[model samples]
Target: MQFTEDKSRSRMTLRSAVPKTEQKPERKQPVQELPYIKYFGNIYYFTDSIDCAIYCDKILSQVDKTPGNTIIGFDMEWPFNFQTGSGKTALIQLSSTIYDCYLFHVTEFKKLPKALTELLSHSNVRLVGVNIKNDIHKLSRDFPGINSTAMLNNCIDLRTQANITLNCKQNWSMAKLVNHFLRMQINKDKRVRNSKWNVVPLNNAQKLYAAIDAYVRITLVEMGDKTKVFQYNYENNTVDICINIPFYDSVEELTYILIKRHDLPIYVDKDLIQKLSDFSLQCNLDYYDNSTTELINHSKLNAAEVEDIIKDWERLMREETADYGEKGCASDEELFATAYHKLVHSPALETMLQLEYMYAQTVRQRVNDKDQQIKSLSETQTDEMNKAVDRLEEDMTEAEINEIAARHFDDQTLLQVKLTSELETIKEAQRREYREWVMQMLEQNQANSSLPTPKNSPLAPVPPGPIRETKEDRRKILQSVVLEESFTIHLGSQLKQMHNIRILSADVMDFCAVNDNEQISDTTPQLLQTALGLYSNDLCGLVLMTDSVIGSRLTKDFTEICQRSTEFHFPHIDDQLEIISNTAKKYQMESCNNRNSSSKHLQPGDVYITRHSNLSQVHIIFHMVSDDSLRANDINSRHPVVLGLRNILKTACSNDITSLTIPLLLQYEMTEEMTVTWCAKRAELVFKCVKGFMIEMASWGGSDLKNLQFLLPQGISSDVFQSLTGMLPSIFKVSNPLILKSSSIVK
Candidate 1:
């Protein structure tokens, strides 16, 4: 190794570095200009069939002669008005590199002809255009075979290609692309307002307009491909554009797409049209040329006024009668009825006829006073002779009575009775009064008779019975019933009785027991009532016992059980009762003592035992209950039972205990049964005994044991011990525990 340091060599290398030079920025390149065509001047106008045919023939010849792939630029122009049913196209213009320019007069093909049919059917020609789908739709009215696939495969749409190539920010229209790329703006004013192509003698301007559209479309196709925005890949025999655009091949497919895009054409009713036309004519009848020309000319009202009156009259008739439904009769009937009703009720119509005889009876009254005068004079006389004559006349007619009276009395007797009786006095009086009235009436009648009787005078006439009012003859109308019959049914007696239960009654237990008797006639009703009562009790009990033994067993060690019980939605009363019973039994069993005690009391060091046949060794959980009433202290204190149960649970679960036997023992000093057999049934006995104690304790002002404390034995592992101990606070506040040494008290 060379021990000499190379410090001089390093210094010489560090000093030999060269100085750096500054560089100048590069200038931007000017954009290259794209090839453009002015596209000015008329491009060979073809307005008539003769010119169109000649143009098409020329283009076809040129296209036929051209070798290799021929790119024919095609576009169609059709009427776009959706309101009209006329399916027509103004022009079909086609152009190619080999051919000059051609315009086909579509109207000549048959003014609203199927241009799509003719063009789409030709397989040899591949049509190309921008957004030709709309054209295909209008054309499909005639040619139905052009669909998505046909247009997509055989026809090339340049708009789609441009979109793919340019990575365009938005869908661009043909006019938009032409202005943006070509920098040439074609006016759309003529395209929309141009004369209907279906009309004959197309103008030169229209023909030129069509030709330029085809040329512009061809230019866009070339620009799209050159930009490499969309690369044409023939490997799959499909054109791969920038975006996936759905295609149509046949007229049916195109029509389906059109329907999906633009909605189907609406059809108007022919009957409605005829009715409206007829109505219009009827409304104009008064002004008909054949009718009185002067009546029409001289009328002060205008046509609109007459029409308004006609409409009003029609509306009135429709409201008054059901000759029409609520929608009213057809317009024709409405117009006719309106005119007829108005004419009949016109004020200018002639008056009705009146009869003289009918008026005479209505105007006259005749009063008879001769009979009254005779009766008054006869009553004043001592009339035995007259009375006898009246009695004889009762059984005989006047002629018979006159003959009998003549046979019975002579003419002298008859004459004396006639002259000397009081009748003469009455006759004389009547004659005097008559002479005076007759003299006065004769004078008045002589005056009035000369001047013709007054027609309206009381002496002249009185109208018959005041002419009965017409309104009295009409009948009162009744309100109409909308529903024919009732559709609901009433429940039977048995079912009704079952529905009358009061769930909240305090005698729920008694009711359930009574309901179980088979002798009860109305079993359903009683059972339903009991079940409802049980449901009410259970719900109320659970709410009240949230801090009791039941709650402790359910809410503390087994909160999930409590949640399920509370969350259970009992739709029927029976279900609620069943759940309460089952829940009570489960809590009672879970809180049982199942560990050993040989000593008088349980202690911390004493081993409690539990054995299963499958287990090789006995499992044990130490017993400890917290003295603090507060739950937090109990949980944190690490009580012996809590720690021992935790260990027992961990071992049992880990070892998979198949069978277990436990011995029950009292924690406090007591002389209670501590045998294994007694402990086996401990849960049931404890529940019954606790329930008894609860009753007595509750009576003594102490809370029920069942509601206060839960019982769990010592001897299980820590996990089990902790779980079991955790339940105690929710029920009873544990205060103390016993400890034993050598089966004897250590304290």
Candidate 2:
């Protein structure tokens, strides 16, 4: 059974292994290029200490002309080797305004000049870049003579600031930030970035890249921070006090975020945050706090943090408030894990507790009164929550239904999937049976009907190899089929009974649902037939025997196949299963109200029917629950599945399903224990049981019970099939026999 894998199949063949020189490179589809970032300004390239110092003086002078914190886009670049790691900072770019930019080639400088360092250290100047902090550290580290960190205290990271203004937290790049705010592309390619930056005179690409990195920061900050609310950090309980603060957000949302993120306290009051905000606004606290130091100078809280105490909060709360049928508190009533456990009680603690208890009682009574009022309000409306939405108009909007469905989407999806799976599993089996039957019938009738061959259509089907048969063969087949026996039999005194019997060595689905689209033609016949009988009185029914388990769960059976398949018609199978389970549970409860019974769950012989359309062959499915007794070696004619089958047959016959498929072994597949003898015995039990039911059918004649099929699972050997076949004819017994004369007598 084992063989070595042919690696050559996956590996490139010798013919495909062309030389690199011979290979013509594939042309990629052209992408529309975005416009590059352009800075329309005076670009000052500084090499020595002298020109750099001059640029520094120019920046310091021009920066504060705007009368506020002047934002200077700052960036640094250095030589980095993948192996040797980073070298000292080689170049730094700074731009105070869009028009003026300075690229300091510090690698050529003797040292960072006093004038340049002082200018960078100047107050009211904000340094901005994607990596502003790290770049400032590099600047200070490269030239330790200058205190770059202290001087560049007013630094704003582009990613952090961009996130604030854009009202979203996302991993942002300098190029992406520029694209989002400035609506232009800045080249951040690997080649340009990894280029030699420690060189003397930079190329056009390097010079432009260096200048744009610093220059775009200023532009982005100017355009992005137009929204007055700069930052509202819940973790720190702080909001940036911008000049034009947006105060239109929900106060409830603010309170929830504060409590959750800040870890303020779990015991949050309903309106605490709203009241404080209102008070601060009404008192004009900002006017008096005008002298507050700049840049997040709020006074820090004196801290000695306590460990969080809350645990099993719901359980503790329930115990603390549980009714003990007395006015005194029990030992279990104490709640140590509560938020207010270590807190001081109110001065009038007893009175407050009494008032709370009274209020709770009043609320309960009021709710009851409201329920009564709701019941009386309209004939359509009910106080029950589940029934409340039932009164919705038939023409309710999809959005409205979606709103309701969203609340219980998990439950609804489970139901839809289960039913859909069940339907599809049956449909798949039916479809397979149909294809095979069609092909077999075609091969048999090939002489009579010529199959059409569509010209040049690859998808068109062709017939299989031919088999010849003569007129004499057909005549003998007809004569033998004639002795298959008449359906009529004298069951009761002077009463003739006619009921058809059929045997199939296939699954149950084959008998119930016929393949509508099996012929070589348009699907018009199939669609028309399906449409007519889909919801008509001539409905097909199936007996889906399952385990004693109530719900239609997936096992290694048809239910599993159903749940695994993707095709199905949906109406929420979950609700149907739940309704059936609940009804069964209710019956058990009422029938054995005072008795100690084991029928709390669904047991043997429990039958529930589900209706379907367009999903499978059968319109109605009777899911009958049986137990392990059916699988027992000593099982008899009184087996639960057999009894359930009798009821199903009665129902199907009365309901006009003249022909029905029933599992002979009460199962769809052959198990390990299903040996030849096992199959024969089970076949005989079901056969004789069905034969008795047919004989009794004359008395309970509500409708004609024409055809009954004993379905053996597929994969049963030819021997087993023949055994069941012989048993069927022998047990049913021919009423009138055709006596063929001997050859000698005929002559």
Candidate 3:
């Protein structure tokens, strides 16, 4: 994959690239008749020297100061390598509509100039290119810290833009965009394309090739404004252009685009449009006249159902406009559009009801608490006032008190009124406090949880579960098992081992609590405290399964972690989420979120590890499957379980976890679906996978293992537990005697 060049450094001189005598090209006015008035006419090269970079900065400064919507073409170049791994970004090419192109020799400059960085990062500037994602990805990989800030913000990927605007089915390359938009072919010389960009003095041909690639992107954007018809001629690999007519993918899309661009309203009668809108909303599907047939087939509706929908549409379109306000207005169009967007995005009605129920229940609980507080305060007030009167009697003689009371009865009455008013004010303050609490709760509950749900979506049918495994079936599974490599699997109760994996049953929202008496942290999943208790300020960590979006409604352990991180001096807690997010970005992967596709699960399994200074250990958080993926009672699919195990082992091998513990049931909360039979089958699956994973760990970069313990859920029947253990002895055993003898003899 390596590219070879001359070993002699003398010939690869940086100064040699620069022309000895500077010759400025005379500027010529752009022809007014051309479709695009301006284009790249000349290019400047910046080498390793400070002088060339300063000149580049000056040229970029001028481009930055130029007028409205300054479109700049951007691209990166590097020597081709056969290996899939990325190579360094050797050159950066930028061209402006001002007809000036700049080639930055990245290897020579070593670092991007401050002015260039600022110009690239400027929010006002638009960076245009084809497949810019690849360029940005490569830039981040090559120059991490420098390019992390260069986020390609306000970037326009011409390929995507062309697909949206021109109905392009294939990815549009620079050459294709030029041929289609400019009605001209650009040179894509293969020899120059594969040239070594890292070579010190790039030749004139290389510079022209680099400059034109960036220049065309800028020119194409300008040409896009004019109304033109494009016809792709596959035979000749060219486009036939006609003025004033644009391509349309569909009637509906075209109609919507026209309405948006021209601010035109639909001329439909009100009554007809209202009925159609209502039907679309009721059906929870987007409405379009052309999509009726497609919807019927996709929804698996019967012929009668399809007829009903057609009749509904027909009745609405035929109705009169008298009942509604006006026809052919923007307001009517907006109403229909709003309904279309809502129906397209809304979840099933049942899910919406569940959300509403949760919100209502939260509000009710807050109100109930406030009522109790108000009652307690009201009852206590009379007793407190009587006690105060008794105290006043004890402090002053009866004769003196009577004399003062007789002289200032109005003052005494005013004092009593003031006390009563003060009490009412306090009660009002409590009511306001309750209202504020509810408002805060409402704000916090705005984000929906990504935790797995049991029900299937409207589009999908539930898959039937496999029949339970019988005793004979279990025996068959163990008898037919084969191993390619050996690893020891032991079952034990002691948690004292240095490299032991302990399993515990945990709740779905287990929060850890900090032990104030001895600095034992309060958190959910008391198992963590138990695990931490095994060490006295010694380094240890455990893996936790959690949601992709960390919610305000966290498990006790998670809440404790956040609380301790903030309230106490646990430094790791502060950066825990940031570390996980940054790591996810670095790996270009995340735990399954709602936006992820069903088939693309566990593509690049990620494990988020965070250190806890308070506990003096690290916590590895593993994301479970998304809400839609769960079967019933939060039981995740088998794929994420396997992925979690693989990620855990992979992370453990690379870090300082001497011992780790996990929940054997995969979850702390047990639903009715999690029966004894289900647990046994799941345990069997986990056992086989763990053995295979451990044996295969060496190839996957795994470290040595000392002890492995499997903990059964306390609820598992003793009979089923015995049976699960029985199958394991057949699969795992100590190392063979011959191997032990051979090792002893070698020693």
Candidate 4:
């Protein structure tokens, strides 16, 4: 039999001269090949022509008919696009066993031929490729929206298989792979590789290059042993790793290489095998009896070199487990016990006893101080309330009282008296409950603070106290408690309204300022400390909103707070910056295309809050779109202000802060855009929103209400302040006006 190619018909034919005894054997045609110089197997190149495509279809059909699995080396080439990383797939090269290679010029045709597509999509065909995922990605990109069911399915990546089985490195260059596996060097000239693949007529080198790439992939797989390739044994929980161990000189070297390659631990178990150092030359004859020499076979280590190697390995293990004077001696424990007993009996014990006594005395003293403060405040509040009630009783004349009673009930009615008494009983129960909760929180804080000191240490420094108390702290504490008391709602009612919320004219930033009120000498901080009566760390954090994206910009008060917190309080400013920056980067800017037509500027409710370095404050940034950009971007006013405030409060509560401060108008800087009418409206909206948010706070998995500071802009005049104040009563119904009016000191 001989094989010959007919260029005119573009087909290869096989012929036999000899005839069989029964009948003449049927003539066979050689595999079709394109009009190229054949080098071993036929190489077929198909272009855009209909006849060429038809010829390619016939070739695929013949290759698909092969028995068993049809192994095809698949590869694709496309021009490089620096901007997009890759362009369209220009060529699709496929090669079969030994004598068949097909080069399909995919770019020439608008769509791939049906027969070619079917062969590619064939489940029976096992297409072998190197880095096939990348090729599939490129193909998908070139033919957008095309069904790639066959391209990826049943695809075996030669590189991946080789890495797991042959210990080949990932991303092995095609040239290096060819040299390594085929033991033959293949030239991959840069000029040829980087050549434009979109050009019509392909160069000889390009053809050879593409063909070799596909052919080599197939040859590599054919050369490898499939059965012994890195099989995993699930039952035994082991891997059957196959490698060319002959590359190493000895079993030890090979083991070392394998351990290093797989990053396996090399620590020897000293308990399992006795170290050579432990096996002294002077053995106990009762146990050893001349069996020591038998442990090492004479025949196995007759040579000095072999004996030396075994000795070296033994020495290595001994060195690894050696103590080397770093650990304590066995007798040290006995010595420690003796010394401890002596110390306990000596004057050191007396000194420790004295220190403990002193610490307990100091603790009691602090506790007494706190108790005194609580007692004074409670007595003052009770006396004040009693006086107010007496004044009200005195103010009402007997005739007026009788008239009021007559208006509400008949002369013989006792129902009014009964209802009044019941109301008083309910109020007393609520007050008791509130007091109990406060006491519990204070006790928990005290227990936490009284952590036991180490027994061995005789002298330990006392922990620092909370931030130094100032007049402003007292004011804030009083105001927060007052506000909390004032905002109580009748839970049974369907409508929950904020009741008796007081309005203050002073700047909220003055919370830490000094006050010289002779009657109330306590500072705001001191008052707040007494009010919380917990660990100083349970302080409230101020949630101030700003308009900066990266937090690089801040308002005056916020900047001052950050500087104070970072410079004097927290030393880890770098870490804080990194965390804030990373979090900021995560919220990427929204594109206009993704924004709604009437709503723009970062989804109205977008707010980011980060804890300040001071650990006492949280800085909140509201993503406020510029006013001019608001119309163009279609941003809603409902969010990033009211909604943002709710989010901030929720965050503060979640962070275990029972008290928080927020600007009522959601702005620290007032502009012409904020008029008196606008301020009143904004204040009213904020008041209602805050009321709802506080009511919902109980269900939002937040801590119980402690304090809330509603700040007004500094620019507001007396009239505007009063106007804003008037709106507060409508939302926050004043239940106890007399108590608030007497103590409410609006700075």
Candidate 5:
């Protein structure tokens, strides 16, 4: 055998040459790398409508043969002037996979392609993207002739899907989603993302960026794992997600490589798996269950094609059941130990889940409330229709009676629609307040408030919001006339430390509404309470001074603020109150001395605690029960309500609550009887008692009160507000040590 071998490639060939092949090393084949994604796709750019249509038609013909729903990644870009806002849509991107992507420059298109339009608006096809609805809206805005909004029924919002699947907020950006799924960077540079889309001959970077954005949409939708993850977008344009245990390795890369090896762009062949998944679409087994012969007959394929499919399914089934070298390689204990190596305890994750559970509960309660409202409205409509029919019998047509009923129904819906979300009732109140304030502003500037427009309606103006003062931007939109004074006061004799003391006339709820009403954006870190504070004992408390009726209907005035929709993770305020009420009943059973006392009824000065997150500012709310004695003209420091305030301060000191908000008047509101003398006395009593409590705080070792805000009613008169504010300084001695500089003249 050796004698016949060629002399040049013979037995000692190891000396002649080292191992080599015709193929060269392949790079990762990254097309564009920015921020964090190595996009691999060929972008097909077309300016002419005809060319685009032809390309799409060719792709569509091929797609028809592919099994499954036709999902298209869709995105758009337009020219923008910093001074004039966004211009008309200049380009639209579409892709089904990384290898296949198209950017149609609509600015150059003399005519929009019917095929492309049909594809976008098709009921069977799904156009997927983050904030896809807004992109579709832009199409209508740019092309006024097309009813894109009404026609686009096939759009799938990845943002919404991410909320359900990833357990992320509904405002995650495309860059964020890509980083999460692909474990790569996505270029979001202002220069690249906000480039000139209307310009002809798109740059290579623009083409690649545009293609990557659109192509990723389909990739995300098709890459179905349905894994729940917790994400925090606490900083600007940055998000951190839960680094889950066990399976957070190269499984994604392995799957991708396997699919690539088989010449598949995305996923491996899953004909059998696909059929099994179809069972979820319906409950009837007959729809999915069929013999191989029947399935083949209905497949509408030739014998050879059908055989190939059957073989693929059978191979997949065998592979699924076959030994994966698990027991042969390692025991169950070894596998578990390996998995445990990657396991981690996430305190932040626990807090987020808690918040999510709370938000879910609030949402459920809101849904129930809305359902009742809708039910009542329906009943009212029925009654009104019946009355109109009876009253107008034979006098008017049935149509006329129906018309009146419809009008009523419409009015009711309009009124109730204001209560849709994000505390619409509060929003409406804000609007009304702004409208009035704007009228006052116009009157101040001598602009005609009664000036009529062409439509003959008076010139009524309202600011964007009544504008909550919690936001720094709130100052930019509106001005406040709140009478406030702040003093840095030292408390505790031995451990005398500086604390923030503020006396302000504002709504009590203002302290609890966690200053998150600003638009949720890349910068906004709303919803979940930060775990940093959760662990460090930097807790917040709000003294919710309540009436002695515990959880009665009379308590809604103050407690309703807590009942409003929280971002996520805390029970509804009413639910918390109910729990507190239940606990109080038990407490009364155990400790009540007076057997004649009305079972669970709370006495004056008795305190009940409720915990919350994502509720405005406070984590713990102390619902201190008090009687109408607060409304009296002459209540001394010995009053039960006063004693309750002392207890609240004491409990707060012993606990980890670093900040506390207490109602200065010991009431949520001011009355006509709460005269200047009464206000001064109440403020003095609270101030002196709080000061004494602070000195006593050092004796009970815990977190010291760093900030104390004495909130007065929003409607407090300037004189009274000032009188109380002045009284605070007189009571709590804010230390102001004078610093003197000595000038040296020594030689």
Candidate 6:
């Protein structure tokens, strides 16, 4: 895996050696000349640093001088693969027939003058491209300012347009469209061929390929009459207009809008990551490496003999319960039974199992040792603090006691602080130690002796420094500190800040009061107020969860509050339907208005209203989206109602309850099985929404829910109705039906 001095050349040689049967043939000559030039399209060709700078200047000047408005087609090509650790867009090839083709070699552009950066960010000039979001993402990775005001105001992404226009069909590729409509083929043989764009003396074929890519986008606009375009009003789903342009503004506005949207967090079993990594390494070490050598040494054996043995082993493993069943095989059962057998049996296979095993074991051991050390240090500090507290309890004067307590607390706190500081100092020393150890080991093995020193290797010596707390840790610390402050200051400040907030207006306040009165019927206003209160209470409970001292108590309070909220449902049938429809639509699903129709269950995007007129009952319906529905189903089948309850549970009770959302189950006269099924589906959806939210949060590097685990307690199974009624009281004793009625059911 280590590269020597001729790393680039080595990589190229390896790429060239790869079997080409599956790959598209490279272009042998420049594309056949066009019979006629029907349109006067602009093509900007950029290859060198000088060309890119000059091209950018020319485009900016044209944008500044253009009258009225100008629409331009744009697209970018970049190098991407597993080899590039940073996943950066190695080169940015942008094109427009109107402005010509410009290949901004991002590698060089990053090093050039900052003037071009400003020109690219210019607001008036729009950039039109297919899936421009990705292009922007790639650009922003290297140049943080690329997305600022300097960039154009309107960034039209053709992918979004195609999605809307084509009713979400799959064929939105640029090449596909050109081939289908324009009767011209734009070759992509070298698009991802891994050629280095930074090299000098580019050939004519590469230049032509770059030029045509830009030209095709421009040509699409000129021939807009040939395809359908979709337009819609911002407020409604109804289509407003249809028109075609070679390019439209990039989806920067939509991107910004989505950036503000929040998603529920997904709960990942952190343990799974380590397990998978270990399992994969073990498999490679045992099977992949050994098989390669075995095949090379026993080249006389026919491939069929090896394949048969693998297949027979797989069948026997499936029938028996052997401890090492598949693990004993060089290839695990899955691999041994599949493509790996053929690969390992190949005469030309390269053997590296023993080497790979040594490398993986070395790395894994180091990481595990570091983790164990950190954990041990933390536990030792905790034990010391406990002992200090026990000793302090012994008879001491008030002043002496106070002084002792303060000193003990400070010392305990500093244990970690000091350890962190020390760790940083030792890290530098360790880096040097690690490097020497690795070099000595490599020399002894003589395996990677020919390889040059790895500059970016994990084992490479690194400078020591304080390990910065993660964003989540920082947020938790801030929340804890804020909570510890005087309540009067915090409460008074919050109230003052919210005095004019529309969510807490006179009307809302009046409704809250009215809803509080047991005498009043559950009117729509009361229902709305109750829902808002539940949401607010849930948020308050979340804030309380951040407090280490009061998390469990706050969670119990939250559950009680939610139970009370859900008891007071909307009195009117129409209002209930409206609430359900509105909530569902906000979550981007259709209202389940026509429940009597063929569709009895709510689909992924369907929201519905169910009215039990006989019982004078109303409920809203929503679906759950989850990647692992089966796992969710198992949990929900045990405790139905607890699935949607957002009540903060005491930390001592059990489970990590980072987030919870209430869901409305709207099925009438349901049997036990039916109710459990319904609740399980709802729970699955809630988990899905949370998972999606977590993904979005992670994408933006949000730290609020980082490292937070979620769990459903055991022993709470069967229909949600029973689970809710039983578990609610045990977890949160203040379970008034009236209070439960007021809780909001979030989609």
Q: Give the best candidate by TM-score.
A: 5
Candidate 3 per-residue lDDT, tens place, 1-747, comes to 001122573111111111222223545333332243223365778775575557656645655554444567898888886775435888889876535677888865556676666667665566888898778777767753444344465567777666544433786788766665465666667888888888877887789888888888766654443233223223344322232212223434533443444444455234323533343343333223324543434234235555787888766765654554235555633543333223223332233223222332333344445446555655565465555557775775667656655545554456556654554454344334433433333334345522223233222343535556568767645633421122344432252212334333323222233222221112222233323333232334454555455322332357444333121112235346666556555444433433464533223233455544223223333444323233233342357656677667666655544455455555545577777777766776777777666665555543454445454544445566566656666655433334455556754
Pitting candidate 3 against candidate 4, the one with the higher lDDT is 4
What global local distance difference test value does model 1 have? 0.37
Off by over 4 Å in 6: 1-51, 85-88, 96-99, 111-115, 148-153, 169-171, 190-193, 225-747
Give the per-residue lDDT digits (tens) of candidate 1, residues 1-747. Answer: 001113653210111011111122345232233333445533555566565555555445544554433456777765555577454666667766312456665555543223333344344555667777766666655543445455445565556555433444467676766665566666566554444766655555566666777888665544333221112222353221221111112423433433343343323224323433343344345234423442453232235556877889888887887775376356733443333233223321111001111121221210013234434444434253465567774765667656655644564455445543443344344334323432343345446532223223233343434423234223211211111111111122243201110111121112112111122212123222212222121111111112222223212332221111111111222233355446645544544334332322232322222111111111111122222231221122243433433333233333333212211122221123433334333323333333233333323431111112222332223443343333323332233345556757565
Error of 2 at 91 (Å): 99
Worst 10-residue lDDT window, candidate 5: 11-20
Q: lDDT-based ranking, best first?
A: 5, 2, 4, 3, 6, 1
- Give the per-residue lDDT digits (tens) of candidate 2, residues 574-681: 445668778877787766734448656666776787655432355667888877677776788777667887888788777776656677778777889888888888
Task: Mark the regions of model 5 whose C-alpha exceeds 4 Å error after superposition.
Answer: 1-481, 492-495, 514-531, 553-575, 595-600, 737-747
lDDT of 4 by residue, 270-374 (tens): 321232112222223322442343233322323564677778887776667675323546563354334333433434444323332333333334434544655
lDDT tens readout by residue for model 6, 9-90? 3210001111223234555323243122232433344446676677677656666765533445555555455765444454
Candidate 1 segments whose C-alpha is farther than 4 A from its true place: 1-38, 45-54, 80-82, 85-87, 111-124, 143-152, 190-195, 222-747
Query: Which residue window of length 10 is worst by lDDT in model 3?
Result: 10-19
List where candidate 2 sits over 4 angstroms from the true fold: 1-493, 509-538, 553-575, 593-596, 735-747
Clashes of 4: 15
lDDT of 6 at 482: 15
TM-score order, best first, reads 5, 4, 2, 3, 6, 1
lDDT winner between candidates 4 and 5: 5
Regions of model 3 farther than 4 Å from truth: 1-539, 552-557, 561-569, 572-607, 613-638, 700-703, 734-747
For each candidate, the alpha-carbon lDDT, in order, equals 0.37, 0.57, 0.50, 0.51, 0.62, 0.38
TM-score of 6: 0.25
Give the lowest summed-lDDT range of ten residues in model 6: 497-506
